[model samples]
Target: MTPSRELWVVLETLHDVTYFTPEARAANESAGLRGFWRGYVATRAAPLGAAGLGLVTAVFHNFAPSFLARSLPSVWEKVSPERALAARLEGAVAALRAHLPEPPARANELLRRAMDGLCWDGRPLGAANAVLPWPDEPTAALWHAATALREHRGDGHVAVLVSEGVSGLEAHVLRDAADGSRELIMPNRGWTDEQWTDAERNLWARGLLDGGGLTDEGNRLREHIEHRTDALATYDLTEAEFAELDGQLRPAARVLVPGAVPHPNPVGTPRP
Candidate 1:
C-alpha cells in the first residue's frame, strides 16, 4: 500500500509518544498545571495563567473540555507566557529522557530543524504562536517541535471543518460515529441535549448521518479529515525523515501501548 497517506498510525504515534512520556505527567502536576487545577482549584493564583481555552485545547488535544474548562481558564486568568511554555516542556523532556535516553546526538537537532520548518503566522487561528517568544531546550524542544507541527495541522483542521460545514461539536460527534465509538466528549464541554439534538438533525438532514449512526458519506468525510490532518502534519518532513521518525517514535509509544501505566493509554495512540 506504499504506506498509508492517512498516516493515522504516525499521527497517533507522535501524539502518544509526547503525551505518555511518564515524566511529562509528573512535570505537569508538580508544575501545578494539573495539580493546581484538578487537585485544588483554589490554590491556582495570579502568576500561573495561560492564553485561553481554545489555544490550550487545540495544542493539548485528547483532553476533555470539562477537565480543561476547570483548570485552563483559571490558569489563563493572567497569561504568563514563559511559565506556560515551561510547564508543557517539562513533561515532554521527562518523556524524552525516559524514552530516548541514549544519545542520537542529533535528536534535538532533528526536532529543532522540523520546528523551524513550521509556518506559524496563524495568530487568531493556532496555538503554537502563544509560546513563540520562548527559547527552546533540547528534549523539551522536541515537544515544541511536535506542538507547532500539530497545531499547524489543527488550524488547518478548523478551516476544513468550517469548509465542510461541520460545526465544532458536530465534528466531534461525527468523529465518534465515524470511528465507531459513541463516547460523548464529556457533558462538561458546555453543550446541552437540545444543542446535540440539533446537531444530529443537521447531520441527518444533510445525509451525513442516518439511523442514529454515521452514514457512508459521514465515514468518507471523517476519513478525509484524518488524511488531510496527517498530510498537513507531515508537510514539513520528507518521506525519508518521516519514515525514520515513525520508526524512532514507535518505541516510546510501544512502552505505553498496552496496560502500561496508571491511566492506561492516556494518550490514546493505537498500536501500529
Candidate 2:
C-alpha cells in the first residue's frame, strides 16, 4: 500500500478504503477479514455526502493554491464523495454536533483539547485558527512582531515553522501582511519583537501556548482518551462503548501495516 493521502484521513467520512468504487469495494470484499471489517464500519455509519463535500472545499480554501492543485484533483479522483463535503464543514460541524450522542460537557472538552493540540503542533489550520473573542487584533499584532523580528535579525525559525505549518492564526497573519503570499519562509510579514512577545504571551495565557511553542499541551494527549471522551459524549458511547470501539479500532494501523494501499478511509473518520 502507498502512503495514504492526508486529505483521505481528514475526509474519512466519505467512503471506504477502495474509494467505494464498485471495483474497489469488490476488491475489499475479496480481501477477506480486513475488507469485511472495513465494510462493517462503513455500513454502520451514516452517509455524509454534503458534509464531506463541504470539508473538501474548506480544505482547498485553507490550503495553498499550488498545494491544492497538486493534491485536490488527485484526491477527487480517489475519493470523489468528499468533494461535496467541502461545502459543508461549517454546517457539517454543526449538524454533527447536534447528532452526536455525547454529552455537552464532553463535546466541549474534546473540541478544546483538539484545538489545543493544533495550536501546539504549529501547523496551519491548527487551533490558532479557532475563533475566540477578538479576531484581527492578536493576529495583526503577531504578524507585526514576526515581521519586525525577520527584518531586524532573521529568526527564520518562525518562518520555517510557519512554512512547515503553524497554526491557522500564524498563516492568517502571514497572509495579511504578505498580501496573500503563501511563502511562509519569506520575510515579507511584519511585526516587532514586543508585538511577537505579546502574541506569545497571549497564547501562553490562553493555555494554548507554552515552552516557546504555539500549540497547547492538551492537543497531543492520547487520541484514545480523547476519542473515548468524544465517543462517550457525542455518540453516546460509554466507557464500555469506547472500549469496544477501541478494541476494533486501530491507531495508525495503516502506518504500521505492510503493503497497505494508500487511500482515504470513509468520511467522518478521525485520525488513528
Candidate 3:
C-alpha cells in the first residue's frame, strides 16, 4: 500500500479517541465487564470466551494471560454474558451522552456517512456492530461509530498478520521484540518457558530477530503491517475528508485522553 498521511491521521486519531472515551471506560468498569466477559466465558458450553476475544486477542496478545484471566476469569453461573455486556454498553453510552450531547445526530452523520462509501463485503462485523441499536444520544452514537471503525481496521490487521504468517503467540513474541521489552509480555501471555522459546525460535528462523533482538528487517515488517492496516482502514475517505475527520475528533480526544491514563499503551500507538 502506498503511504498515506490521511490514513494515519484518521486511523490513529479515531483509535486514540475510543481509548480515551471516558464514557465507555466508565460503563465497562461500572458494569464490571471484566467479570461479565469472564463470566460469559465461564458460562459458555465450550469456554469460547476463554478462547480469548477472537481477533482482539492478537491486539492485546502481548499482555500476560494472567491479567486477562484475572479480569475476565471463569465465573459462569453468576451472570449471562449477554446481560452483562448490555449493561456495560448502556451505562457507557449514557456517559457518552453526558460528555457530548447528541452524539448520534452530528458525530454519526459525519462519520457514518463517510463509512457508507466503503465496501463491507467479506469483513466480519465485530462486537461493535453486533446490533444496530443506535442510541438517541449523540455521544453514544459517536462511541458506536468509533468502535465499528476501529474493529474494521482491527479485522483487516488480523488478515494482514495471517497472510504474513504470524500466529497469535508468535505475533505476541515478535511484537515484544520490536518494543525492546522482555519483561512485559512473557509472563502475561501464560506461556511456559518452553512455549516462549519455541516462539522465538520460529521468529529467528523467519529472520525477523537475532541475538540482539528485532533485526532491521523485522522492524520494517512490523511498520509495514501497521501502515497497511491504517491505509486499509481509510479506504472510504479522500485525503481531505480523512483530515476533516481527524480534525473533528482531535479536540474531543484532547479533552478525554488526559483523564484516561494508565491505559495499556500498547506498542502500536504513538504517545499522544
Candidate 4:
C-alpha cells in the first residue's frame, strides 16, 4: 500500500472502533438514539450540528437516501446534536481505554500538528470535526484526532468520486467489483437489487465494468481516484513525520484489525 493509504488504514481503524464497540452502542442508546443505524447516523452527523437530510446526504456522499431518511431528522428529535456528539466521544474514549489504557501521547501530538491550519474548503465534515474542542483525556484526544483526519481524507475521496462522474451507488458498485465484496457492501449501503443492477448496467455502458468485475479502464479510474485522494489527504506532514506517526499507531491497529474493526465490512477498510 502507499504511505497515505497505509496511514488511512490505521487511522480509520482507530476512528471506527467507536461504531462497533458495545460501549458506543450503549452510550448512543442512553442518549436516546437507539439501534445501530440510528447511532451510526447520529454520531457521525452530530459533528455537523443538527445537519439536515440534504446536507448529510451531500457530505456523506454514499448510503441510499431512503436509508438515511430512516434515522436522520427523526434521530434529532430523540437526541439533540450536542448530546449525540458527547455520546460518541464518550463511547469512543471508553472503547479505546479498554484496549489501550495508556494513550499514545506522541501520536496525539503529531496528529494535532497535522490537522492544525488544515484547509477546510470543500471538506465540511473534516472542518467541523477539526474545530471541536479537544477532549481533556489523552485517549479521547487520540480518537478525536483520528476522527478528524479520517474525515478529512473521506471528504477528499468524495470529491474524487464526484469528479470521476461516479454516483454514490456507482462508487460502491465499482468498489465491490474491485474488492470482490459485493455481498457485504450492497446490503450494508441499503441499495436495492434493482438499484445495484442499474448501477452495474451504467458502469457496463461506460466500459468500467463487465460480468461483476471492473474492466481495465475501471481499474485505472479507481487507482487514479485513490491516488488523488492520497494526495489530497497528505496535508503538510513531511515524510519523516508520517513515518513517525505510522510507527506510533501501527501497533494499536495490529491489535484492532479483524477484532475491533472487521475485514470485509461496510466501511471498505481493508485489513492492513
Candidate 5:
C-alpha cells in the first residue's frame, strides 16, 4: 500500500473507537439515543446537523435507506445534533485513554497539519467535520482530526463508487465477494437476502462475478476503485511525514484490532 493508504488504515482504527467501543455506545444511550443502530446513525451523522434521510443516504452512500430511516430525524428528535457530537467525542476520548498510550505531541501536530491541507470539495462529511471546533484535550483533538481525515477519504471513496456506477448495495456485494465476507457484510449493511441475490445477478450481467468469486473483470474494477480512492485520499504530507504519522499510530491500531475494532468489519477497514 502507498503511504497515504497505510495512514488511512491506522487512522481509521483511531477514529472508529467512537463507533465500536463500549464507552461510545454508553454515551450514546445516555444521551437518549436508545439502540445501537440509532446511536450509530446519530453520532456519525451528527456532524451534518440534523441531516434528512436523502442527504444522509447520498453522502453515507452504503447503508440501506430503509435502515437509515429507522433512526434518522427521529434520532435528531431524541437528541440534538450538538449533543450527539459531544457524546461521541466524549466516548472516543474515554476509549482512547483506556486503550492507547498517550500520543506523541508531534503526532497530533502532524494530524492537524494533514487536516489543514484537506481539500473539501465534494467531500460533504469531511467538510462538515473539518469545520467543527477542535477539542481542548489532546486526545480529543487527535480523534477529531482523525475523524475528519477518515471521512474525507470516505467521501472520496463514495465518489469513486458513484463514478463506477456502483450503488451502495452493489458496492457491498462486490466487496464481500472479493474479500470472502458476505455473511458479515450483508446483515451489517441491512441488505436483504433477496437484495443481495439481485445484486449478484446484476454483477453477473456486468460479468463481474461467477460462482467461485470475482471474475477477472470484477477484480479489475475493484482494484481501480481502491486505487482511485487512494489517489483522492492522498494528502499534502511528505513521504517522511506519512512515515512518522504511521509509526506513531500503528501501535495503537494494533492494540485496537480484534479488541475494540473487529477484523472483517462491516466498515471494510483491515487490521493495521
Candidate 6:
C-alpha cells in the first residue's frame, strides 16, 4: 500500500481503538478532540496529502506532555504480535528516522538499549516481574511511567531521575502523595502495598532507579521509550494492512501508546 493510504488506515485503526478503549476516549474528551485533531492534520498536511492524516491525527491530536506516554505502548499491544513486537518497533524507528532531514543515529542506538532493558531480551511483558493484582498490568504501567520519564528528560540518567520524579509516580498511582512510593492500579478494585514493593524492586533492578534515582541504564531505557513513542506517532499503516500490521506491532505499539482493554493488575486483583 502507498504511504498516504497507510497513514489513513492507521488513523482509522486509532479511532476504532480510541472509542473501543473507554479510558482513551475519555482522556481525549478533556483535550477538545476535534480542534486538536485539526491542528495535526494542518501540520502534517504535506505528508498526509489528499487522504490527509485521517484518524491517526484525530486520535493523537492533543500531543500533551504525557499523551504519548500512556498511548504508544498500549497501541502497540493492540497492533503487534508477541513474537515480532521488537522488530516492528525497530521498523517504527526506521520510518521516523527517514522522515527526519538529519536523524540522530546515536539517539536511535540509545533507544535500542532502552528497549532491550524493557523487553527483557526482547520478550513480551519482559519488564518487571508480575507484582500487581492482575498479571498483565505491571508491564503497561511500568512502561507508562518509563515513557513519562523519557519525555521529561532526553534519556540522560540524571535528568530522568531529577525531572521525572520517580517517587512521585509511585505515590501518584498509589494515592499516598508521598515520594518514592509506587501503586498498582487495581482495574476494578483498589491498591496494595505488597504489589507496590515488588514493582519498586523490579523497577530498581531494571535500572528504573538507583540509590539517588534513575540509573544510567534507566535513562537509556527512558530514551528508547520516548523515541519509540515518537516513531509510532510518525508511523503509518494502510487500511488492508492494518490488521496484518497490528499483529506484528502489538508489543512496541502498545509501548508507544497504551490504549488497550482493561489491563490486568500484576499485584492483587483476581485474574480472569
**What would the TM-score be for candidate 5 when compared with the true structure?**
0.97
**Sliding window of 10 residues with minimal summed lDDT for model 4:** 263-272
TM-score of 6: 0.23
The digit string of per-residue lDDT tens for model 6 on 1-272 reads 33322322332322222222433333333333323222222222211222222332332222222333333333323322221222222222333222222322232233233344332221112121111122133333323232322222222222223344443234233232222223333221222455556646766665666666666766675555444434423222334444444343333333323333223322111111
Q: How does model 2 score by TM-score?
A: 0.26
Which candidate comes out best when scored by lDDT? 5
lDDT winner, 2 or 3 = 3
Error of 6 at 41 (Å): 30
Q: Which parts of model 6 have CA positions greater than 4 angstroms off?
A: 1-191, 235-272
Output the lDDT of residue 21, model 5: 87
TM-score of 4: 0.96
Tens-place lDDT per residue, model 5, 38-140, is: 8888989999999999999999888888889899778788899999999999989988888875865688889988888878999999999999998878899
Model 1, residue 198: what's the lDDT? 84
Clash pairs, model 5 backbone: none
Whole-model Cα lDDT of every candidate shown, in order = 0.53, 0.30, 0.54, 0.87, 0.88, 0.32
lDDT of 1 by residue, 67-86 (tens): 56776566654334455445
Q: Residue 222 deviation, candidate 1, in Å?
A: 2.1
**How many Å off is the CA of 230 in candidate 5?**
0.5
Candidate 4: tens digits of C-alpha lDDT, residues 171-215: 988888876677987777788999999999999999999875889
Error of 3 at 45 (Å): 15
Model 3: lDDT equals 0.54
Error of 2 at 84 (Å): 12
* Global local distance difference test of model 6: 0.32
Please tell me which model should have the higher lDDT, number 4 or number 6: 4
Give per-residue lDDT, candidate 2, residue 118. 28
